[model samples]
Target: MPCHLILSKLADKCPSAVLAVLDSLVEPPQKTVNFKPKQDAVKQEVDHNEDMIRSALRAIASLNRISGGDCNLKFKSLMSEISKSPMLWDKYYSIRNE
Candidate 1:
């Protein structure tokens, strides 16, 4: 099963723990500033971070579905954070419409 599905199932049994995991997963990885990175490396990191955010949004949507909208407050808070970046907010808005 996909990680999101597994997490959704686990949410029924331990919502708090599952939410904690999701919260961590939703955070973007920090950029390493100690070295001058290549353009390709920067592009790859951006792509990876985008993918992570998309996955985390999917998981949150799944959780909201399974929990019958109980996750709305958390989702709203996440959306606020996501909205700080126009690119990410655009991605999220598209996903949310799907």
Candidate 2:
């Protein structure tokens, strides 16, 4: 998870400098599929994506704080998505360890 995303949600009162540092953490090495929104209205979907990212970062940080260890990137990715929806988080966690 990106640090900015974690800080954005956990400490909304954080300074822009923290935001800037978080921004720098987003440089992932994985290849991504380019998504093209068909309409400007779909931009909200993009914003949601950003929100999801932020949420997940928060969740990952929370998980780390709770577990006291580094979460694998794959687990962090799943944690991020799960954080966005409580139902999904419960469902995922239920099935994840099985």
Candidate 3:
């Protein structure tokens, strides 16, 4: 979020800088794996991975609000995927409890 704040402050003066930061916020897709034997371990790993993705998407969504493009759809799509997961929306909000 600090990066989001810094980028937003720079956005008014330099939109290109904002776009660059937004573009970088998009993380590469993680490789899909199947771990049938260690179900709990795999679920933990997946939750952590999805949290990372959710974080990036949240930042991107914030940037999209300031930048004003069709990019919100992209961020929303990934967010929907997270919502559809077994872990649901809890992991995304769980950090706030801390």
Global Cα RMSD, each model: 6.2, 12.4, 6.6
lDDT of 1 at 69: 40
Off by over 4 Å in 3: 1-16, 20-41, 71-98
Per-residue alpha-carbon lDDT of model 3 for 1-98, expressed as tens digits?
35544544565567666665544443332111111234556777777655555554444444445645445454455556655765544654453243
How close to the true structure is residue 25 of candidate 3, measured as C-alpha lDDT? 41
Lowest lDDT sum, 10 consecutive residues, model 3, at: 28-37
**Residue by residue across 1-98, what tens digits does model 2's lDDT show?**
36435543543444344334433333331111112345665778877655554444443343334332233454455446556768655544543343
Give the lowest summed-lDDT range of ten residues in model 2.
26-35
How much lDDT does each candidate structure score?
A: 0.54, 0.43, 0.47
Candidate 1 is scored at a TM of 0.45
* Predicted structure with the largest lDDT when compared to the true one: 1
Q: Model 1 over residues 61-95: C-alpha lDDT tens digits?
A: 55555443445555556656667868666765676
TM-score to native of every candidate shown: 0.45, 0.31, 0.37
Candidate 3 TM-score over all chains jointly: 0.37
